[model samples]
Target: MADIESEQAAAAAGSGALVLFSGGQDSSTCLAWALERFGTVETLGFDYGQRHRVELECRDALRQGLTDLNAGWAARLGPDHTVNLAALGEISNTALTRDVAIAMSEGGLPNTFVPGRNLIFLTFAATLAYRRGLKHIVAGMCETDYSGYPDCRDDTIKALQVALNLGMDRRFVLHTPLMWIDKAETWALTARLGGEPLVALIREQSHSCYLGDRSHHHEWGFGCGTCPACQLRAEGYRRFVAAAV
Candidate 1:
């Protein structure tokens, strides 16, 4: 099984990949993962009017930081693309898109759950990849240690991969490297990928706070330190640090 996976990874390394980068820790880690493997790597972000829209602002700096970490990454990194997905926000009544408090919805999910967000994102990513002639669409969607967003499940991604290929008549591989890994593992992966420098870059530049609060800096990063995103990141960083010690 390991040999087969290695062969698959080697085959994928020869192709170009489009990373769905949101300028958050997981997406940033996934971006580094793509840059290290794919022959060419491009980034695509969505401006969905998220309350944490500040994350979008972190994209360029993170990209530059990644490029600075390695000459090869700089050479392999391609153009960045941002699509205006403001319509998603208009339709979403969740806390992430509105001024509402973060709470559990009556549907047994968090109010931050943007319905069909990832599905729409993947569909649009597939469209962009098709136009860009890219063969791989990389995302940071993960099930482990997430906020119960159904769209982040591995099965959802796998099903969407089939739908996209069938609908587009193209062989587009959707890569979610963080699917099975927890947030602590994600931070550890970044350290392994580019060492402490990459880890520091992610901690400082990436924005994952639901409230868009960059005013307060935590050891993990800049956030409100209470939102689900921030809490998860902080706890993960604590674990990462403790494990390192």
Candidate 2:
């Protein structure tokens, strides 16, 4: 994490960063991290026609919430970008895209894993950053505690950065604040970057459950707390809280 911290300090000290905001706990926290570190920060989201459009919809309310939390600081985060990836569902088939039970895929990976989703996401993020002359692109992808998505791995992102830079002939560094941290650390990150208000807001507002069930409430949020995503989030939150105590 020393390298990541150094890069983060540099990004914060330099121009600005563009974050891949998903309106979930991880991404929301990452947004705060970017805002705290970078001189200027922007956000982007993907409308990939997932099973639940709640995450996409939450992006706006989330941004407004950020502004509401710290108006003076939030305004510099820049305008939000929502790319139309509706056709992406045509190529990818998973519980995230279609109506399938939350189970495992053919290779024993989570059923919710949308093949190449991150690839497409980062590619678009890099392109957007490149055009905007932004050097850093931040994401909330985590490997320590996650849904078993391969694309979220650190190596995969590093490779993609290299490939994207080579293909576009531009230098765009991808920052993953939650790459090595678990969900618990993610919650801590939110607190560290945005304080208690942000931690509370994310716990109550961010939509992370794959089932899209917001009825059952917990310390971790409105997740069903059964889906793979929910389970990870709940466990992480529990651990984070326990450790803090």
> TM-scores of all models?
0.96, 0.92
lDDT of each: 0.95, 0.85
Q: Per-residue alpha-carbon lDDT of model 2 for 1-245, expressed as tens digits?
A: 99998996775667868999988888888888877777788899998888766887778878888888886557667978889998898788888888888777678898888889999999999888888888889998878987678999999999999999899998888989888887887888888877889988888888888877878899888878788888888888899889898
Count of backbone clashes for each model?
0, 1
TM-score of 2: 0.92
Clash list (residue pairs), candidate 1: none
The TM-score measured for candidate 1 stands at 0.96
What residue runs in model 1 are displaced by over 4 Å at the alpha carbon?
1-10
38-126: candidate 1 lDDT, tens digit per residue: 98999999999999999999999999999999999999999999999999999999999999899998889999999999999999999
Candidate achieving the largest lDDT? 1
Q: Which number leads on TM-score? A: 1
Cα displacement (Å) at residue 218, model 2: 1.8
Q: For model 2, what is the C-alpha lDDT against the true structure?
A: 0.85
Worst lDDT 10-window in candidate 1? 6-15
